[model samples]
Target: MAKGIHQEIIGRPHNLLEHYQPIDGVVDEMVDASGNPRPVWKDFIEALEGLGPEKLAQRFARADQYLRDAGVYYR
Candidate 1:
C-alpha cells in the first residue's frame, strides 16, 4: 500500500474492519500494518460488505455460473 494515499468510506452501513484479524507473519496487500484498509481496497471491500450475505451469495453464485459457462474448470 502506498503511503499518503487515503480513501473515505461514504454511507458505510457497517465497519467492515470489525471482522478482520491480521495474522502475525502474513503479509496483507489490502490492509496496512496498523489494520487500516489500503486506499484501493477500501471502497471495493466496503461495497462488497454492503451487499449483505444473501446478495453476496447470489453474486458469488452468478460468478460461479459465469465461470462454469466459460468452461473454467479445475481438477
Candidate 2:
C-alpha cells in the first residue's frame, strides 16, 4: 500500500507530455507526436508506468544523491 508521487502532487493534471509537440521531418526518440509510446519504448515505458511516480521520484533522488556523493558533475 504505497502512495505514488502522482498521489503526493494531488489536484494537478498528470500529462507527461503536455508541452511536447513533434515537428515535421524529425524523429522522436521515445514518444510520438500524439504522446503515445513508440514501438521500441513500449516495454520500457510499461515498466516505468508500473513503478508509478513516487517510486520514480525516489529513484531519481537516490541517483542524484549518489552522483553528488561520488562527485560526478556535468559541465
Candidate 3:
C-alpha cells in the first residue's frame, strides 16, 4: 500500500503531528534499537499532513531542498 494509505490505516493524524515537533539545537528524535534514542526529521512534516498528499509531498520536497540549500542537509 502507499504511504498515505498506510498512515490512514494506522490512524495517526495526531501522532503524525506529534512526531514532527520542532526543537532548537537539534534535528529530531526517535526511538532506536535497544530502546535507545536517535534523531530524525530536520524539518516539520506533520503540518503538511492536513494539506493532502500531493501538497504534503510538494511541501516536503521544497523543505528538503531548502535544507539542502541552507547546508543543513545534503542530497
Candidate 4:
C-alpha cells in the first residue's frame, strides 16, 4: 500500500494540482509532491522495508488482535 501510494504520487504530472491541496504554510507530512519520502520518514520507511511483507502482515494482525482484545473501536 505504501508502494502504491508512492507510485500514485510519482505518476502524476507536476502541473496537476487538483488532486490535493496543502494546508497554508505546512509541508506535506508524508511524501513530497514528487512522491519522494521526506527525510524525517527515512528511518520509518527503512524499518518497514526491513520488516518485509510477511513480517509486517504478522505485526499488523497482532496489533489488530490486541485492539480487539482491548475493545478498541471507531464509531
lDDT of 2 by residue, 1-75 (tens): 234333443332344444557777898888876778789987876675566666766775666667768998654
| CA lDDT scores, all candidates in order | 0.68, 0.63, 0.47, 0.58
lDDT string, candidate 3, 1-75, tens digits: 223233342334434445534455564455333333344532344444556655555555666666667978433
* TM-score of each model, paired residue for residue: 0.59, 0.57, 0.35, 0.59
Q: Among these predicted structures, which one has the highest lDDT?
A: 1
- The per-candidate count of clashes, in order, stands at 0, 1, 0, 0
* lDDT by residue for model 4 (1-75), tens: 223233343433433333546555677886676756679987787786566555665666666667668988644
Clashes of 2: 1
Query: How much lDDT does candidate 3 score?
Result: 0.47
Score candidate 2 by TM-score against the native. 0.57
Q: Which has the higher TM-score value, candidate number 3 or candidate number 4?
A: 4
Shift in Å, residue 66, candidate 3: 0.4
Model 4: weakest 10-residue lDDT segment is 1-10
lDDT of 2 at 27: 84
